[model samples]
Target: MPEPIIEIKDLTKDYEGKRAVDHLNLNINKGEIFGLLGPNGAGKTTVILMLLGLSEPTGGSIKISGYDSTTEPLKVKKITGYLPDQVGFYENRTGLENLLYTARLNGISGKRAYESAEKLLDIVGLREAKYKKTGIYSKGMKQRLGLADVLIKEPEIIILDEPTIGIDPKGINEFLDLIRKLSKDKGITVLLSSHLLHQVQKICDRVGLFVDGRLLAEGNIDEMAEKLFNNKEIAIKAQVSNITQDLIDDLKKIEGIRKVSYSGDWLIIKSIENVTPAIAKSIIAKGGSLYQLSYEKYGLDEIYQYYFEGGVRHD
Candidate 1:
């Protein structure tokens, strides 16, 4: 385990009479990509904004690298870069110009800003079009440019909100690759908030599941699965040729095996523990040819669905 660079405790935000964030607590480790997940109206953006000190918390505290987000916001801003759901850039300004402007705002100037901006433009794959006005850039290009703009501050932490929301599949893939590369190469911590479960599953090291402003669970894929499926049965699917009723009965008789049934060429096995290898051996011994055998594991989407619908208790 790594040291936690961001520690949040009892963080809360109230919107008029409604509670947007209800006592959320989380620890984000240094150099790790942590995904903040939930449906719309779940306060995911509120948490992110509070983390960056862009919005004040109604209650509780947030410490980033020991700098209090509420009190020493300037210090927090120096090390944190935030990209909103919709990135804004001067449409008339060239991509290079936008980055340079950000650099100047951060107190970097002259050769340093220019050189740094060039490298970042190249890093984000916008070098050739660096001088072209951003108005001519596509949505993906603007997103990439926004990334370069954020990097102008040399932030230790990068926070992105729904970065791939409207991106085409190909563009989303490219952007995600760049995000992973940046984190790995720069040793920068990243906190991502998105409703896209598959995309988050592809990259997040761990995730905090949020619902109605409260964290329902915080864990990696396997850990959350264990918590949610503590007593659930495992399903195994096997495709075999020339199956027999006798073989099904034999499989059902195996201790710990809950159920056995076959449909067409697919044999479904329900068991408490993994006994696929034994099942395969038995099928082979029964003079059956095995073509495919696989056990089913819950994907993030499935696990998320189970968590919310199962009425998970927030801890």
Candidate 2:
């Protein structure tokens, strides 16, 4: 495996008498979108603050690109770009002016800065709006500009905290697609922190479940389901033209099938693996018509429901 671009070991944080983060350990691979998934006040923001060297950890360590966040904070910040929940810009300045100002702050002024700023504006789909004052831009437009601001520094890693909080559904989709495109094209590692499960699941290559400042699990959706459910049986739903006791019994007898039953016009089969192919063949051989077949996808929705709402202990 490749070395992780971000590494945290035994990280902990405290505010007053309460512990905000508890012995958190995580590693993020280079160029992959890693989501910090959790509910509000779950210490996700604390972790990001510590990673960016904006806040000190109460204990343990954080390393980004071989630089210690606590000791070499300047070095860490030099290559890391952060976009907080709210993005602020010079409201009176045009979008292009705002980007140019950022470029100048980073010491890339003159024709090069102007050219880069214009290109970034086009890449972010704001070329036409480039000359418009940010005060008149909508929330989605501001977010797009915020992303352009972050990229102006040309950082290797970008940390976004609740980046899509108030945007409409369509805008959210477009923003996510842009993030994915940047990660793939520029090979920039992205660390996204969000409480929206479905949105995170849509674009994240992997995710870490954080609750109450503790990371319960981290992996892809399927891998996390297996870890949390202990390889729990899957349910397959099928709709056929005919249903009979004989057919149900035959389905139960199929290898890997644990149980079979019917409801209305649908058949519900609980199995250890996908047996849809076998099920369709049996339906046709039994002089029945197979109308529909669907296997339950083990996704973030189910995982979140099972762990948080189902009262299943992570331990």
Candidate 3:
């Protein structure tokens, strides 16, 4: 396995006698989208700042690509890009102009900046609206422009804080797709921090769940589900015209089949593993016709609610 590009150990932060981030420890692998997920004031923003070298940690260590983020801020900043929850752009300036201006600020100007700005504008899908004044741009368009603004620096790591906040569902979907592309195509490590559970659940490769300044859990969805629910219970719902007590009895006899019940035409199943295939096969073997089978798998939202509701799970 590749080494982690960002590593945090015992990271803590305090503000005015309150602990904002507590003994935070986690890792972000290269070219992967790592989500720092939590509600507001969960220290997500503070962690982003520390990763970007914008703020100091009261204690602990942060290393980005082997450079100490606290002491070697210049080296860290050079490879990291940040987009705040609300990105600020000049309303009077055109999208193209905004990126070009930012490129110049990063010390790359003239033709090089123009080319880079134009390419990024195209990359973020804002090229058609590039010449228009950003004051007339919609919130989604502005968000895309903000993305292009950050990419002008050509940073290897991108930190986005609630990038989809206030975006329409369609826009949010598009933005998440763009994020996936950034990691796959550019090999850039992305740290997305947000309170929105479903959106984060959809795109993140791995996630660290934070609550009140501490990380409560960290892993992929399956791992999280295992940690939270002891191998998540899958509910398979099926519709069948033919019903039989014999069919129910046979399904219950199957190994690892936790439970089985039905209502009207809906056959509901509870299992540790996928029993849909077995159920369908049994339906065919019997005189029943399988009309429909749909299953629901547990994701971050379910596990999040479990922890958020104060339930504990064993490793």
Most lDDT-accurate candidate: 2
Q: Which portions of model 2 miss their true places by more than 4 Å?
A: 231-297, 310-312
Deviation in Å, model 3, residue 219 alpha carbon: 1.4
Clashing pairs in 2: none
Better of 1 and 3 by lDDT: 1
What value does the lDDT take at residue 212 in candidate 2?
Answer: 82
Candidate 3, 10-56: lDDT as tens digits? 99999999999989889889999988888887889999899878899
Per residue, candidate 1 scores C-alpha lDDT tens digits across 1-315 of 679999999999999999999998999999999999888778999998888888999999999999999898999999999899999789999998889999998999999999999999989899899999999999999889888888889999999999998789999999998999999999999999998888898899999889889998889988987776777667799999988998998788777799897899999887888899899989998999999999887657667775566656645
Scored by lDDT, model 3 comes in at 0.87
TM-score of each predicted structure versus truth: 0.82, 0.81, 0.79
lDDT of the candidates, in the order given: 0.89, 0.90, 0.87
Candidate 1 — which pairs collide? none
Give per-residue CA lDDT, model 2, range 109-154, as digits (tens).
Answer: 9998899889889988999999999999998888999899889888
Q: Sort by lDDT, best first.
A: 2, 1, 3
Candidate 3: misplaced stretches above 4 Å? 231-297, 310-315
